[model samples]
Structures are given as C-alpha cells and as structure tokens.
Target: MSVLRINVILFGIGNIGSALINQVLESQQFFREKRNIDLRFPIITNSTLAFFEKEGVKNAWEANFDQLAIPFTIEGIIEFAQNKGLENVIAVDATASSELVKHYIPLIQNGFNIVAVNQNANVLHIDFYKEIRRNLKKFDKTFLYETNIEAGIPVLKLISDLYYSGEKITKIRGVFSDSLSYVFNRFSSEDVPFSKILNDAEKRGLLKKDFRDELSGVEVAKKLLVLARELGKNTEFLDIKISSLFYDDLEGTNLKSKFYFDADILDKYLEIAKITQVKNEVLRYVGEISIADEKLEVKLISEPITSAIGQLKGSETVFEIYTESHGNVPIIVHGDSSRKKTTTIARGILTDILKVAEKIKIKETVWL
Candidate 1:
C-alpha cells in the first residue's frame, strides 16, 4: 500500500466550510485505514480572519478559531505555508466571494492545487477563465471544481468527458438552481402561496440567495456559461439570453427591497402555474444551450408532470444531456439534493480533494 498526504487550506467558515471541517474530522480515520489517504487541514479561514492549525483541526476547532484566528491577507497565508514547509498543499474554496477569486492564480503559483466550491471563479469574464487555465497548465497543477454547478452532481464532468471523447453534444438542459427548484416544484403542485414556500425555505436556510434573486435566473445563467465554456464555446456571460420569471414591471420593486413584499409575487407564480396545469404540464426554470444555434438560454418552461424534471421533490435537480451518439434519448442526471445539503456538498468538495491527491501521486509506497 502507498500512503498519500493531502493538506487542505480551507476558505469560508460559513455553512459549507463548517460542514467540510466536520466531515474531515469524522472521515480522517476512514481514509487513513481504508484508502491510505492522510487528509489534514493545516489552515482554515473566512473572509476576514484565519486560523493556523499546527497539528490539524480537532473537535474543538470552532472554539480554537474563536480564540486564535486573526486578520489575514493572501500574502500572509503564502508566507505562513512557506515557513511551515507544508507539502502536497491543496486550497479548497467554499466561499462565494469574487474578491477571494482574485487570489486563485497567486495561490496556484505558490504550489497549490485548487478544489473550488465557488462558482464565480469559473463564470467570471472569459479572459480570466482562459488565463486561469493557462496558469494551471504552466504550473502543471490540477484544478477540480465539480461542485461549481449542480451542487456536486458531476454534471460538468459528464459534459467534459463526452466532449473530450469526440462526441458532439447537441444540447444540455436542466433545472440548475436548488433554491429555485424547491420554490417552483412546490408552486407547481401545491396550492400554497409562493410567498409562504419562499419564506419557509429561507427560514430553513435553504434559500442560498434571496428568493427574489433566484427568480432573476442570473445564477442559473452562470451555470450555463460554465458548461458552455467547458464545451470550448468562445462565449461571454452576456451572450446568454436570460428570461426572468418575474415580469419587467416588478424589477424595480425587487431592487428596492432585500426581499420585497411578496403577496403579489405569489399571484404571478400562481398564474403561471395555472397555465401549466391546464395543459397537463408543470412549471420549471430551465437552462439549455443548443450548440447548433450557438446560443444559450435560461428561462421558465412547462414540462410534462411525468417527465424527469417534473418529478423533482424538495430541492432535487435533474439534467437532460443531448449528444450526437444518443440521438433523441438524452442522458438524465439527478442531483444529490438532500434537504440536508451541507453534508452532501462537503462530501463533494472532499471528493475533489481526493482527485487532486490521486492525480499528483503524493504518496509513499509501503508493504502491509
């Protein structure tokens, strides 16, 4: 057996970050015994403060961070890693901050492979996207970010595999947003007011963005752009045409309020639901790109209730992939959309870490 040591510098101590720490602590032993993988977190950080764990995190990691974390800059992190002589370093980004993305290139240059749970880093300006890829190649470092879209559903990897195999992908479409999926899924089948379900999801910490923001379809569009770029499309973010679920007249009202009063918003969603119901269809916010037309779309469409996308429950997501080999039968993927999503998402991030570890072969052989 060979033992591999994986060191992770985790960013973002919010929901996903905290969950990842818990997962690492809980699974550290299993990986060591079963896989010969010694995974450790030597450093952890949020947006403003960082904690340097000399011996890796313990169960009391949260308490230690409260007592020992200090304000930090990217320069300080690089210096600390250098001074400690940490090897086989991987930086895991679990934050949604665009500013944090500015440091990705620097970290990669400083001998770090990146495992991102962040989407902005992939969907930013196309030039930056290309530049990051160039740097990764130049440094001979691996970058894995399966959780960037579909909450770790492996949809991006599927697309990449098909494209790399010389298969022509005709189109890819799905209900991409978990928050929006839950809201619309409920609205389509139940008689409850949309505002009630929206607020309830917020109370349960299910709404990652404000419910209204999910209605704008910007996040779903970003997912589409990332997938498009994966297909070697020279596409810009602005190139995708977005159709907001909310009408144009309501845009101003949404901007003025963090979560605008929504009794009326309920009416709009209900009206659309009624239209879909009459045709034996259900409302779904879908993102689709037809490569033949060279255009991307994010909009609301009516799907047959018996269809794969329509059968979604809670925040579950599905993808319908169309490729030249499959003809009319598209590959359908179901997301790991458990209501307790932090655990599943953290596991996804951990899977990416193992990918980097296995790829770089930072291992020592031993006879057992």
Candidate 2:
C-alpha cells in the first residue's frame, strides 16, 4: 500500500484545538485505510507551551505535553516544517489571537495551506485581506476558513459557491451570533427580566464574559463585513451602521453591570418586546447586506413567526442567500443552535483539512 502523508501544524490547544487533536488521532487509522491519507500532527501548541513529534504524538498527548513540551516560537515551527520537505503541510489555527494571524501571509508563502476558525484574519483591513488572497494564488496554496463565521455552518462557502456558479447574489441576511440569539430568544419568549437572561447567558458561556462584546453589536457587524467583502461589495467595518442592543441612556455606568443598577435599560427591551408581541413577532439580532441598495446593517429587529429567521429556536443561526437563480425564495443554511460546541467547530476545521488533502494526488505511480 502507498501512503499519502500530510503533516499538521496546529496552534491553540484550547477546547477546540484539543478536540481537533483528539479527533485526528482517533480517525488517523480510518483515514489511512480508507482514503490513503496519513495525517500527522507534528506540532501542537497553545500560546506558551507546545508538543512536537515528527511522527505524530501519542493518543494521550495532553498528559504527555504537560511534562514534555518545551518553549517554542512560530519561527521554529515554520523552520521545522520546511526542513521536513513534505508535499502536503496544513496549518490549522483555532486561536482568536490576531498576533498569530499576522503570520498567515508568510505561512502561505512558505507552502503551508491554512485552515482556521479565527475570524480576525478574514475580517482584516480590506487591503490586507486582499493581499492574503493574492499570496495564496501566487504561491499555489490554499486558505480555507469555513468555520470563521457561525461555527462552521459553511456560510462563507455557500456564498462563494453560489457566486462562482454564475448566480447573481443580490441580498444576504441572517441571525449571526449564538450568544445574541440565545439572549434575545429567551428574552423575547419569557417574561424574565432582560438582565436576568443576560446574566444567565454569561454564566452559561453563551455570551462573552464582558457582555458588551455581544451587546455592542460589533461581533455581528464584523461578520457582516466579512460577508460583504465576499459578495464583492466595497465596504469596511465603519461603513456598516450598527444598532446596539444596549440602550444609550446608560452610557457611563459600567454597562457590563448595568442590568443591576439601571433597570430602565431592561424596560427599553420590554417595550420593544411588548410591541413585537402585539404584532405577533419575535425579536432577533439580524445582520443584513443588500448589494442593490448598497446597505449593510446589524440590528435588533422583530420578524414574524412565519419567517424562516423568526421561527428559529434556542441559539440557532439561519442564513438566507438571495441569488438571481434562486429568486425571492432565498437559499437557506441553518445551524442547529449548537454551534458553540468545541467538537462542532473542530469538525468544521477537519472538513477544511480534508478539502486540502483532496488536492494531493498520485505524483508518480508505483507497482507493488
């Protein structure tokens, strides 16, 4: 049997990273036997500690890494991969650190195909984002980041696929954030205080610990910006007008804890919720981009229960893509409200990895 070997250099050994490493180890043999691909994790790391084994680490790498891994730098990792002379080298990033994203261009230039869940790189300055794409083409390397948005719902891939398939995309809209979805869904359906629901979400890890990270609407805005660029719209972060879920009346009283001191902010949400209730609708944090109108906005709006977005339950995310061929009934991709799970995100990263592997074919045929 011939072995098609591929080396993996993974960064970020947090929940998502650890899950990916585990999945790789568990499925290594299956992939080898079924697909003729030998996946190797030569380097696995977090921000400070890392474990390096050229033959791939043992199945129980976590216990061993704690004792064995030494201090290493990104430069060292790059040098090691280069010296190995492997044909397929994939760098998988699960970290949110922008510092690591700074090395993406260089990594691609060094013949390392990248698969990342980090959104920072994809939503970088328009110029830099374009530059990275240019490098990937120039070096004949691949950069797949289908997990960058909405926990690997393949939303970005859906856009690109339709765009390249001769479909004229006119509008893209969706409920984009899990945290926001959970917060608003519960707040709308239940009579619980908005502050209580917000607190519950934060404690349950549904919302960012800082709270404003989701309440400020920046996350949804960033996601919209990423999609806008993909749709060939010339726009930047500032170009999108955002409607914050938090009220402006409480601008200075530490909004993170405002729910405790300022109950009036909750009143604002209640007023909107009651109004929507009378209208027989649900509140959803929605992001929209209209190519024809040249508009991009992220806001907390109410949609009728009959609508695809309004019928969403729990933390589910729904994307409605309007293309010329699809007409008024847009193509929808739905996430099962469980995108925050580490395993799901890791699975998305693995999907991208295999996509890169498919490019490696029989360079030379040999008879046994």
Candidate 3:
C-alpha cells in the first residue's frame, strides 16, 4: 500500500486544539491502514509559542511542546513551510482569536489550505469574505470549517447541496448554538435562577470564558451568516438583527471586559421563563435565515415544549432546512455537539481533512 503524506500546521493549543492533536496522533495507524494516508503535524502552536519538527509529533507532543516549543510568528510559520518545500499543507486554526484571522490570506497565498474551527474568518466583513473565497480559487486551495456551525451536524453541506441542486430553499432555521441551547433549556425547565445555569455552562466549557460572549447572540448570528453565505446569499454579518440574551441588558458590559454576575440582570431571564411557561412554551435561542428575502436573525424565541426547537435538551443544536419540495416537512438536522464538544469538533476537523485528502487522491488518480 502506498502512503500519501499530508502536513498539518496547527494553531491554538487550547481545548479543541489539544483534542484534535490527540485524535490525529491516535488514529494515525487507522488512517494509514485503512485510508492509505499519513497525517503529519510538523508544527503545533499556541498563541505565542510553537513546536516544530520535520518528522511530525508522536505520542509525546505535550512533553515536546512543554520542553521544546519556542516563540514564533505567522511570518516565521509561513517561512518555515516555504523553506521546507512543504506541499499538501493544511493549516488548522483552532483559536478563538480574531487577530489570527489576518494570516489566513497569507497562508493561502503561501500554498496552505485552511480548516478553521473559529468563526472570525468566515464572518468577517463581506469584502474580506469574498476576498478569501477569491484567494482560495486563485490559489487552488480548499477551506473547510464545518466546526463553526455545529461540529457533528452536516447542515453546511446540506445547505450547499440544496442550493446547488436548484432547490428553492425559503428558510433555514433552528437552535444553532449548543451553549445557548443548554442555557435556555435549563432556564425554561428549572425554577432555579438563570445565573446558575449560565455559571454551570461556563464551567462545562460550553461557553466562552466570559458567558456574555455566547449570550450576545453574535456567535450564533455569525453562524447564521456563514450558512446564508454558503447558500449563495451575500448577507453581511452586521446586517443580521441579533436579539441578544445579555449584551443589551448589562449597564457597562462590552465584549472585552464583560463578566457581569448581577442578580438583577439575571432576573429578566427568570421572568421571561416564568411568563412564557404560563402559555405552555419554553424559550430557545435560535437563528433563522430567509433566503427568499435574505433576512437573518438570532434571538430568544418562545416555542411549545413539544416543538422541535423547544424540545432541545441540554446543549443540543438543530438545523431545519425549508424548501419548496419539502413544503410542510422541513429537513431537520440535529446534533448534541456539546455532549463531548471537543471530541466532536476533533472528529469534524478530521472529516474536513479527509475531504481535502480525498480530493488530492482523485487528482492524483486523474493525473496518473
């Protein structure tokens, strides 16, 4: 059996990052034996430091990172690849940092495909989004970031297929955030304070370090924008009307320094839950995209406990795709990505890598 070597340069050695590395390393034998592919991680980076080795990491990447990783920059990473004559390079961005997004164009230009687990690059200004796609085409590189929407769900590909197949998709709607799903599900069912659920979600790593980040609804809105764009809509992220669960309520909370734990602020959610309960409805944070009109929204909405969106439990995310053919019965794609978020995300990343690898294999066969 012949083996095809593909190099992976990983960024962000945080939770998801570490999980992906372990998954890749552990599954090496399986990939090699079954798929005839060898994935090599020549570089693994945190925000500032990186572990670089030509032969790729082994079972001791953690120790290697701790003992041998050195400070590095994006330029240094690019130069390292260029000097090493690396090909079939896939750059994995597992960071939540917006600053790291600026390097994506450079990496693509320097012969690197992208597999981003972050939303920053995909939900940037419309011009930059177009530019990135344009660069991908011009450079003949693939960019896949299915983890941005819902890691275990195939909604992105579903939307893309429906759009390309000439389906008249009128709307795409559902609970898009696992964190928000977990937050709202508990708030609606439990009589406990909303802060308790929020605090618990934060501890479980379902939320950003700052709980308000997920509650702002921007993350979910960005996800909506991503899907809309995938379905051929030119909607900008700013155009989406985000019905925030937290940002507007706080007196002095911006994104950077937002960590409000006031009892008064959390009371509104409790009140909403109680008031909605009288009507036999529960609250859910959801995103909806109307392709016929190109309108997008992310907000806290009320649904019957029996309804699909409302029935979502603890960190479950669902996506419903509406089309002319489907009529009353929309295609529902649901997942519980938050149950094992990091592992699911790691699987998603590997799936994307295989997509690229499959393409390379096809190209090689055609050439031969």
For model 3, the local distance difference test gives: 0.83
- Which of 2 and 3 is the better model by lDDT? 3
Model 2, 331-367: lDDT tens per residue? Answer: 9888766545788899889989998887754332422
Each candidate's clash count = 0, 0, 0
lDDT of 3 by residue, 96-209 (tens): 889999889999999899998888988888889999999999998999998888789767877888889899898989998788888778888787777777778878877778
Where does candidate 3 stray beyond 4 Å? 54-59, 247-249, 254-261, 268-273, 276-278
For model 1, the stretches where C-alpha displacement exceeds 4 angstroms are 55-59, 253-262, 269-273, 276-278, 362-368
Q: Between candidates 1 and 2, name the one with more favorable lDDT.
A: 1
Q: In angstroms, give how far residue 101 of model 3 lies from its true place.
A: 1.6
Candidate 1 per-residue lDDT, tens place, 208-229, comes to 5445557778889988988999
